[model samples]
Every structure is written in structure tokens, then in C-alpha cells.
Target: MKIFTPIIINGLAVKNRTVMAPMCMYSAQEDGFVSQFHRVHYPTRAYGGIGLIIQEATAIEPRGRITDHDLGIWSDEHGLGLKELVSMVHMAGGKMAIQLAHAGRKSRNTFEPIVSSCNQRFNDKYDIPKQLSISEIKDIVAAFKQGAKRAKEAGYDGIEIHGAHGYLINQFLSPFTNKRDDEYGGSLEKRTRFLLEILTAVREVWRGPLWVRLSADEYIEQGHRLEDTLKVIDLIKHLIDAVNVSSGGISPSVPKVFPGYQLAFSAAIREKGLLTFGGGLINSIEEAEQALAKEKADLIYFGRPLLLRPFIVLEAAKTYAPELVIPQYERG
Candidate 1:
């Protein structure tokens, strides 16, 4: 099946098409350091035989955290634990990617005033964020570059920039969240400026399989849709390896979702000449194969299923790759 086949991105040859999507565990310490929970939680998926496992959203700065518990890469000290985490995952036979993120208006962990493309509040529940100044935006761009350096130091196989789910980058890309009239907002090109800067900055420090997770659709009328993202991809495909296609989170409106609801977006984006990581509620290997077969996505990621069954890959290899012998008695 295409699901078990190797695929190359840039120069990185992943052993299979299956990936454990980056899902926030929110289990880090108050200082945003890796905890025992992360040590055990991640490697289990590696032991399960996943080809690539992208770690959850890790903050680039203190105020950038979504919550106090979010993992961070804003400092070198954070690199020590992350390097060990990568070693553990590799020992268990999996490649690791780290998602560098900043929570924007959605941040609830910082005492400093929250900031975003515009002075907006996600809702009354989140703090009212102040609009970012030109210089401050440049500083945040530098922060992402610094975060990529830390990921490289941590021995991560890849780096994924969290440009999705109404985060800082998303806030700028979407029309609904970004109300500024300046260079960082308004027209699509201007709105894409911040993300372009971040990507450019990150590339200066790291030379691995780089990815950007994008909310292809905001699920709101005034927001960006798949077409908008395709345009964005055309501009940045030269700088990154893949696009992790996802939707929603720019607004409070809850979208009607279903299994494989996002595959079409990924397929569309892939058609636009770039690799994509696509999955939305897809739990079956058959579904994974169908997506890969149809060229809907270059890779398939399982989020909740991996949480419940970390051994899904091992279970799959029994049927698809009988030559393997991890669970010796059961496999043979």
C-alpha cells in the first residue's frame, strides 16, 4: 500500500507515509520545559512504529505560549531537554519534527500585554491583545528564527512553523482576525509579509525538512480559503518542504467537521505543486491508503487515534509489512 512506502522530502527519506500529527498535550512545566510526561508520551508513538512524529506547538517566547504549560524553544536551556527527547524518540525508531509556535491573542499564560496583527480579542475569555508595532513584529520574526536554531540544536529531524489555527501567523493571514491597514495586513501579499519574514528568518538558521502548518480555510466568509492558501504556498514553496493542511480556528465559529473533511483541501493544494500532510479524523489505514493513492496528500497524520492506540503502526505492519518482527510472537 502507498501508506507503507517511503517518500522523500528535500533530502529526508521517511521510511513510511504515516505520521503522528502534532497535537498539544499541554503537559509541560510552568517554565515551559519538557516534563516526564512528554518523555514517556512521545516515545511510545515511536515504539509504535510511526515514521515521523511532529511534537506539539512549542512557544518561541514567554508571551507566545498558548498556556503556561506549553513547551517552549525560546532559550538554549530548552534545547537540552529537547535534544534528549529527540534521542529517546530516535532510540525507539522514529524521526522527530518540532512545531515552533506563538499563540498571539489566544495566549493566556503571559502577564505582558498580548499582541497580534491587530488589537483584537479572540473572545472575552482571552485577553485583549494590543496591536504590534513595526519594530515589535520584526522582533517576533527574530524569535521564530531563534526557535528554529534551538530545534536544530535539539537534533530535530525537521522543523514545522505553526502558521495555523488562529495563532500569530494565522492572525495575520486571515482577513477576519487581521484588521490592520499597514504592510502586515490588508491585501493578501501584505498579509503574507509576516509569514514570509518568519520563513525567511527560520531558513537562515536551520537546514532541515522545514514545514508550515496552515489553516487552509478559516471556515468564515471573510477569511482565507483553500485558494488563498494555494496562493500563499506558491509564494513560499521554494522555502519549505511541505504544507500541513488544516482548517478553522481564526474565529469563534465552530465548523461542521467530519472524517476526511480536509482531504479535498490538501488535494487541491498538492495539485498546486507542493507536498501536503493531510488528515482530519482519519483513523483507518484503508483511509490513509486511499488518500495516498489518490495523491490527496504526501503523508497522512493520525491525531486522536495515536493517543488511544500508540501501537497502530505496529499493528498495521503485521498485515502490510509482515517482514517486521517487533511484537515477535504476534507478527510471525
Candidate 2:
């Protein structure tokens, strides 16, 4: 059987198992508006035969942006430009999704980043983010909702809350960054309360497909573990439609491998009966097929490979299932 088979999430139908992973292009204008670069950069992959295309990590609030150059959906102005990008993907015959994110302690304000809790000398360049007051936390939640709303209005098929990579959401979910004592801190349940709250609120605004990107484990001790993710998945099984499995932080340096090194995590989520997307080192047709045959993941995501080969999915489909035909333009 081919790995590229139809899978359904909520009401959205993914045409194949191959997904185009969200990558940071940092090509947005200073005002956080999508440019021609964002439009042409994304839709072409879908045209090349990707089943799903996730927009880059978009900051929910101004302070939440990793770089001033990162994409944002905090306001309607952003939605205006994003509408064009989303439309391009759909017109190319692919499903589109957005990754709503906030860079908590990880804010790359080389100009002035913000931290959620206390400073640990990691704030030489980026401004130390003040510990969010009860009120500030509420505002942040609202920002997620606003971001979700904009994504929907912009015509995206779904939204993926970016809770991995030690960003704002991940910081609170992991034990290493969040040090609060209020309802938002201490104990795994309390630490997890923040992510659930955001998910609950975003769910209210976005009625379509809902997905979450989670770090299976930060790959660090005292940080989030597979058990932590499983616990959250248990709670989210009802609210979420799918879970995208990923790991590492903004600064990642892992040993190089062929592809599908992280399939085990997706398999864990799959055990829960919730649809899962496997990312990280996913590169060839054979690897993609093995992921499905072994039940490691339901969907496979491609990242860096898209930049090197725009029509990789089409090529892979031909290799894995030679009976499939390729368009004349895609052959070259």
C-alpha cells in the first residue's frame, strides 16, 4: 500500500500523506504583512503535489514574534494579505493550515525580545520578557483567539497551535522555563493548564480543523517528556483533530539521519486513535512509504526538501507507485 493515501481530519480531506511542513522564511515586511515572496513560496509546493501546506510559524502578538520579520496574524491588516496566500494554495488544489505561535522566552528580539518568567542571563540582546501578570496572560490567550480568527477569515482550512520549540506555549508546558506559582504553574497539570486554555479559546473561534504541534520531548531532562505529551493528547483527543509530531527548540543540533527519525512519537499518538503527522528528517519516497506501512504516522511532512526540490512529492509518488502519472511541466 502507498503511504500517500487520503486521510480525514475533522471535515478536511488531505488528498495524500505528503504534507509541506511550515518553515521560517522571515520574508514578511516590517509591518508583518505577506509579500509576493510568501505567496509564490508557498502555493508552488501545493501545485507540485503536496496534500497539505502549513504556513510558517506566525506570531499571535507583536511581542510574541521571534523576529520582527516573522509573519503575524494579530490584526485584520495581516489577514488582508494572508487571504491572498491562502487562496493561492487552495487554487493549486491543496489544503492549507496555519501554525499560530508565540515566542515566550524564546523571543528573538535581537532588537528587544521578551521573556515570560525571570531572566537567566539569556537576555543580553533580546529584552527579558517580564513574567506575565494574571491580566497579561489573559491578554495573551485573547491574542491566540484573534490569530485563529484571522486565519479562518483568511480562508485557511485549519490552524495548528505552535506549542513546540520552547516558544511561549512550550515554555509554560515544559518544566525548564515556566516558574510561576499561580494556577498556571507547578505540577504537570498546572503547567499544562496554559496550553489547554489556549486550545479551548482557539477552538471557540476556529470551527474547522484544529491541530497542535508538540515537541515529543524537548530532548532535555526536566523538560517535557513523552508522558507529558501523552497526557496532553489524552485531554486534547476530543478537541483536536490532529497532532503534528516534532521536537527541538529554535536552536537545534541533532545528529543527521536519512529521514523519519521521529516516527516513534507519531506512532505513540496514533495509538490514542488520534490522527498524527510525522516530521523531522522526512526525505524520500521509500521513507515516507515505510512510515505508513509500519503505522508510525498517518501523515508525513517535508521541510528543507521543498527548497531543494519543489516537485519532490510528485517525484516520490512516481517512485513509490510508478503507475501514477506526472504532469509534463513537472517532469523537468
Q: Compare the candidates by lDDT and give the number of the best one.
A: 1
**Among all windows of ten consecutive residues in candidate 1, which has the lowest summed lDDT?**
323-332
List the candidate 1 regions with Cα displacement exceeding 4 Å.
Answer: 325-332
Error of 2 at 281 (Å): 0.8
For residues 72-95, what per-residue lDDT tens digits would candidate 1 score against the true structure?
Answer: 888899999999999999998789
221-251 per-residue lDDT for model 2 (tens digits): 7677788889878876778888999986723
Error of 2 at 174 (Å): 0.6
Give the distance in Å from residue 133's predicted Cα in candidate 2 to where it truly belongs.
0.9
Quote the lDDT for 237 in model 1.
83
lDDT of each: 0.90, 0.81
TM per candidate:
0.97, 0.93
